[model samples]
Target chain A: MKQAVEELRRQAAGLLKEERVKCVIGWTQGTDVARAVPFFATSVRQAARLTWTPFCVNNLSKYLLNHRYDNTPLAVVVKGCDSRGINRLVQDRQFVRERVVVLGLPCGGMLDREKVLRVVDPGAALQEVEDRGSEYMLRTDKGEYGFEKREALLSKCLECEHNIPVVSDLMIGPQVPSPAGSGIDRFAGVRELETRDPAVRSTFWDRHFARCLRCYACRNVCPACNCKECSFEQAVPGWQQGACWLSKRNHPGQNYLFHLIRMFHVAGRCIDCGECARVCPVNIPLRELYRKVMKDAEELFAMKTPGTDPEEVPLLSTYRTDDPEEFS
Target chain B: MLVSRLLEYVGLEPGRFEMRWISASEGGKVAETVREMTERIRKLGPNRKMRDER
Candidate 1:
C-alpha cells in the first residue's frame, strides 16, 4: 500500500512536471485518520501530498464535469468502483477521452468510518495501513487496530465486482483480491423489498423519504447525473413555464416525486457506484431503489449493467425488435 | 412497462397504473381501454400512497 502511494505521488508529479495534464485529481490526508478528501494537484509540490488508503472512498470522476468546457487536460485517480464514472461520462459524450488521463488503482475495500471509529480512537492520527488479505491493520498514533474486511468494509465493497478498474491509462499497484465472496447476491436487498406487500413497501420508503432534506447531495455527487441544467434547479428558461418541477417546500408527495423522477431519469445509465446512498445524510437505502430498476431492466430487456462497457449504447436510448411489450 | 414496475416497487397498486396502445383511428379501442383501466382503478380505491396530506 505504501509503495502504491509513493508511485501515485511520483506519477502525479511526473504528469504535472511534464505538463502532461493541467491538474491531477487524487486524495490527500484529511483532518482525521478515517477520512481522505479529494485534492487537486496542479504543481509538483501539491502532487507529493497525494496519498492512498482504505479511506479514499469518494468517486473523483464527477469532478471531470468541472473541466468539461475549459478544454484543459486533466488526470484523475480512480479505484475500481470510481472508474465506472469515467465510462459513464465518456459514454454520455459529456467528456472526451483524449482530454484526460486515467490512473487506476486496484482497491481491496474501503472502511466504513463510523464502524472504524467504534474500534479506533476518534482523534487517532493514522500513520500506516497494511492489508492482510482478510483484514486491515491500522497503525495509528494512539495504537494499532485490526479490522476484519467483512465487518469494517463499506456494504458496497463487500459485493463489489470491479476491484480492478475496467479502464485505465496506467495501473498504479499490484492487484488485490476482491473482498466479495463468490456467492454474494448484490440484489438481495431489492428482492426483499419486492416481496413485501404494496402498502408495506409504501410505508417503508415513506419512512426514509420523509426525512429527506432535499439537499441534492446525491445528485451533485452522481457521475451519471451529468445534466447541464437539472430540472430540480430553479430558473430554467422553458420548463413548466419556468416554474420548478417540484416546489421548494419539502412535502412528502414532492419528495417522492423528486426521487422517482431522478430514478427514472437515470434508470439505464446508473453505474451502481452507491454514491447516492453513501452521501445521503438521512441514510436512505438509495442503492436498493436504483438496483430495482437495474434488475427490472435486466429481466425485461436482458440488459447488461450500465457503464460496464464503454462501447455499449444506453439501455433506454436504443431498442431491439424483440423488446418486450407485454404491457402494451 | 418500466414505469409501472417502478410504481409497483414503490408501493403503488399495480391496477392504479396501466398502458395500452390505441391508434388515432381506433377510437372505440381507446374508449374500451380507458373503461377497463377506470374500472380496475375504481376497485383499487383512492391512491393515498404518494398523496400530499398536508
Candidate 2:
C-alpha cells in the first residue's frame, strides 16, 4: 500500500507537470488519523500530497459536476465503488469521458473508523498503514496495532462487488482480490425487510425518517443526483401558480415524502455506492431502501446493476413489449 | 408498477393504490375502475402515513 501511495503521488505530479489536467482530485491526511478528506491538486507541489489508505472512502466522482460547464480537463482518483460513479456520470450525460482522466485503485476494503478506534489508540497519529491480505497493520506513534479486515471493514465493503475500478484510464496499483465472497447476497438486507410485516416496516422507516434534518448531504454527495435544479430546492413563492411539492416544515409527513420521493427519483439510476447511507447523520439504512427498488427491477425486468456498463440503457427510461402487465 | 411496489414497501395498504390503463373510448371502464378504487380506499380508511396534519 505504501508503494501504491508513492506511485499515486508520482503519477499525480507527472500529470500536473505535463499540463494534462487542470486539477487532480484525490485524498489527503485529514485532521485525525482515523480519517482521510478529499484533496484537489492544482500544481505539482500539491499533487505530492496525495495519499491512499483504507480511510479514503469518499466517492470523488461527484466533484466532476463542479466543472461540468468548464472546459478544463480534470483527473480523479477512484476506488472500486467510486469508479462506478464515473460510469454513472458519463451514462447520465452529466460528464464527458474525453475531458477527464480516471486513476483507478483496486481496493481490498475500507476500514470503519469507529471499529478501528476500538482497537487502536484514538489519539495516536497514524504514521503508516500496511495491507496484509486479511488484516491491516497500523503503525502509529503510540504503537503498532493489527486490525482484522473482517472486523474492521465498513459494512459496505463486506459485500463489495467491484474491487477493481469498472472504468479507468490508468491502474494505480496491482489488482487486489475483492473482499466480498461470491456467495454473498447483495439483496440480503432487502429480503429481511420484505419478510417483515408491512406495519413493522412502516414503523421502522418512520422512526428513521423522523430523525432526518433535511441537510441534503446525501444528495450532494451522490453522483446520480446530478440534476442542475433539484425539485427539493425549488424557491417558488407560496402564492405562485407552480407550488412546491413539499413544504419547508420539519413535520414527520414531509420527511416521509422527502425520503420516498428521493428513493423513487433514484430508483433505477442509483449506482449503489452506499454514500447516502454513509453520509446520513441519523444512520438511516438508505441502501436498503434503494436496494429494494434494484431487487424489484431485477425480478421484473431482469436489469443488471446500474453503472456497471456505460453503453447499457437505463432500466426505467426504456420499456419493452414483454414488460410485466400485472398491475394493469 | 414500480411506484405501487414502493408504496407497499413503505407500509401503505396495497389495496389503496392501483394502476390501470383505459382508452378514451372506454368511459364505462374508467367509471367502473374509479368506483371500485373508491370503495377499496374507503374500506382501507384514511391514509395516515404521509398525510400532513395541517
Candidate 3:
C-alpha cells in the first residue's frame, strides 16, 4: 500500500513539473484518522501531500466536472468505481475525454467511516493503512490496529464488481484480483424491501427521508448529476406555473420528491459508484433506490450497466421494437 | 417503491401503479399477486391522498 502511494506521488509530481496538468486531485489524510478528504495538488511540491489508502472512498471523478472549463488539463486519481463515473461523463459529452488525464488506482476495498470513527481515538491522525490478504492494518498516531476485511469494508466494496479501472491513462498499482464475493447480490438490498407490502415500503422510505436536511450532499456527490441549471435550484423556464417541484419546506412529500426525481434523472446513467449513499449525512440507502432502476433496466430492457461500455447506446436512448410495453 | 412514490406525489394513486412478473411455471404466484393487490384496492376503496396544493 505504501509503494502505491509513493508511486502515485512521484507520478503526480512529474505531471505537475512537466506542465502536463494544472492540478492533481487525490485523497489526503483528513483532520482525523477515519477521514480521507479530497486533496488538490497544484504544484510539484504539493504532490507529496497526496496519499492513497484504504480510506480513500470518494469518487474523485466527479470533481473533474469542476475543471471542465479550465484551459489546463487536470489529472484525476480514480478507483475502479470512480473510473466508471468518468466514462459516464465522457459518454454524456459533458467534457471531451482528452482534456483530463486519468490516473487509475487498483482498489482493495475501503473502510466505512462510521465504523472507523467508533474504534479510533479522538483527534487521531491516520499514518498508514497496510492491506493484508484478508484484513487491514490501520496505523494511526495513537497506535496500530487490525480489522478483518469482512467487518471493516464498505458494503459497496464488499460486492465490488471491478477492482481495476476498465480504462486508464496510467495505473498506480498492479492489477489486484477482486476478492471472492458470493451471495452478495447488488440488488439484494432492494429485494429485501420489495418483499414488503407496497404501503409498508412507502412507510419505510418516508421514515428515512423525513430525516433529510436537504443539504444536497447526495446530489452534489453524484457524478451523473451534472446539470447547468438544476430543476430543483429554482423555478424552471417551463413547467406548471414555472415553479420547481422541490420546496424549501421540510415536508416528507418534498423529501420523497427530491430523491425520487434524482433517482429517475439518473436512471439509465448512474454507474452505481455508491458516492451518493456514501456522502449522504442522514444515511439513506440511496444506492438501493438507484439499483432498483438498474435492476429494472437490466431485466426489462436487457440493458448492460451504464458507463461500462462507452460505445454502447444508453439504455433509455436506444429502444427495441419488441421492447417490453406491459408497463405502458 | 421510488416510482410509486413519484406517482403518488403528483396526485396519482399508488394503487394505479403496476409491475409484472413472468414465469411460465408459476401461474399460481401470478394469480396470488393479482388477487392480493385486488383485495388491497377493495379495502382501501378510492385514494384521495393527494395534497391540497391549490
Candidate 4:
C-alpha cells in the first residue's frame, strides 16, 4: 500500500507537468487512517501530499460533479466504482468525455468503519487506526490491537467484483483478479418486504420517512442526481409545492414520494457506489433499495448502468416493442 | 425526456409520443395519459423498428 501511494504520487506529479491538465484529483490519508480526504493537485509539489490507505473509503467521483470550467481539462483518479460515476455523468451529457483524462487504480475493498471499531478496542477507545491487510493495527495507549480484514469490510465491498477499474486512460498497479464472495441478491430483502401487504410496506416506510429531515444530503452527494435545475426546486411547475412538513407545503408523502420517484428515475443508471447510504444521517440502507433496482435492471433488461457503453440508451428511454408484460 | 432521447439514440425516427408532466394529485389521470400516449405511439409504429440497421 505504501509503495502504491508513492507510485500514485509520481504519476500525479508527472501528469501535472504535462501542461495539458489543469488539475489532478485523488485521495490522501486523513489526520488518521480512519478517513481519506480528497486531494486536488494543481502543481507537482501538491501531488506529493496525496496518499492512499485502507481507511480512504469515500468515493472521489462526487468532486467531479460540481467541476465546471470553460477551458482546461481535468484529470481524475478513479477506482472501478468511481469510474462508474464518470460513466453516469457522461451518459447524462453533463460533462464532455474528451475533456477529462482518467487515472484508474486497482482497488482492494475499502475498510468499513464499524467493522474496524469492533476489532480494535471492542470496548476500548481507538483514537486512530490503519488497515495493514493481515490485521488492522489501532492506536491505543494501552497497546495496538489487530484484526482480520473480513471483519471490517463495508457491505458493498464484501461483494465487489470490479476491484480493478473498468475504464481509464492510464491504469496504475496490476489489475486485481475478480473479487470473491457468494453472489449477493441485492434485492432479496426488498422483495421480502414487498411480499407483505401494501399497507404493511407503507407502514414500514412511514417510520423510515418520518426520520428524514430533508437535509437533501443523499441527493446532494449522489453523482446521478446532478441536474442544473432539479425538478423538486422548479417553482413554475411546483412539483411538490408546499412539500415540507414544517413549511406550509401540505403535500402528503412528498418526501418519500420524491425519493421513490428519483430512485426509479435513476434505476438503470445508478452505479451503486453507496454514497447515498454512507452520507445519510438517518442511517437508511438506501443502497439496498438502489441495489435492488440495479439487480432488476440487469435481470430484466440486461442493463448495468453507467458501467456499460456510455452510448447505449438508458433503460427507460428505449422501450422494446415487446417489453415484459408482467405489469400489464 | 429520457424516452424521447433514447429513441433518438437508437436512430429511431420521430414518433407521435408525447412527454407529459403529471402531478401526484393528478394520479387518477395517469391511466388516461398513458392510454393517449400509447395510442399515438402505436400509430407511429415501434420507434426502434423504423430505424435502418445500425
What DockQ results do all the predictions give, each relative to the true complex?
0.58, 0.62, 0.10, 0.03
For this target, which candidate reaches the highest lDDT against the unseen true structure?
1
lDDT of each: 0.90, 0.88, 0.80, 0.66
Better structure of 1 and 4 per TM-score? 1
Which residue runs does candidate 2 get wrong by more than 4 Å? A238-242
Candidates ranked, most accurate by lDDT first = 1, 2, 3, 4
Q: What is candidate 1's CA lDDT for residue A216? A: 93
Worst 10 residues of 4 chain B by lDDT: B3-12
Model 3: per-residue lDDT, tens digit, A1-328? 8889999999999999999999999998787777778999999899999998888889998998886766669899999888888899998887888888899999888887778778888598777788886888888889988988889889888888777886679999766667436667877776777667667766677678878888999889888888966767755455545355656567666776677778888888999899888778888888887888887778777777788887867776776888767542
| lDDT at residue A207 of model 4 (Cα atoms) | 63
Q: What are the clashing pairs of model 4?
A: A242-A249
Candidate 1 chain A weakest lDDT stretch, 10 residues: A236-245
lDDT of 1 by residue, A79-194 (tens): 98899889999999887998999999999999999999888887888888888888999999999999999999998999897999888899998889998877998888899999
What digit string (tens of lDDT, one per residue) describes model 4 on residues A1-328?
Answer: 5556777889888888886687888887565335678889989999898876656666766777667546568888887777888788888877788888888877766777666655544445434454453455566665676655566667676667467776788887655543335666555665676466645655555666557666778888888888766665555534335442223132334555556666766767777778888899988767766766665667667776555466777776788976544322
Expressed as tens digits, the lDDT of each residue in A1-328 for candidate 2 is 8888999999999999999999999999888878899999999999988999999989999999999988989999999889989999998888799999999999989999998877776778888888888888889998998888888898789889888999999999777778786688889888988889998998998898888898888889999899998888876666234466776578778888988888878888899999999999889888988888999998988878888888878887898998988755
> Model 3 compared with the native: what TM-score?
0.86
TM-score of each: 0.96, 0.97, 0.86, 0.75
Evaluated on CA atoms against the true complex, candidate 4 attains a DockQ of: 0.03
Superposed on the true interface residues, model 4 gives a C-alpha RMSD in angstroms of: 18.8
Clashing pairs in 2: none
Kindly report the docking quality category of candidate 1.
medium
lDDT score at residue A203, model 2, on the 0-100 scale: 93
| 3 against 4, candidate with superior DockQ | 3
Ranking of all candidate structures by their TM-score, best first: 2, 1, 3, 4
Of candidates 4 and 2, the better by lDDT: 2
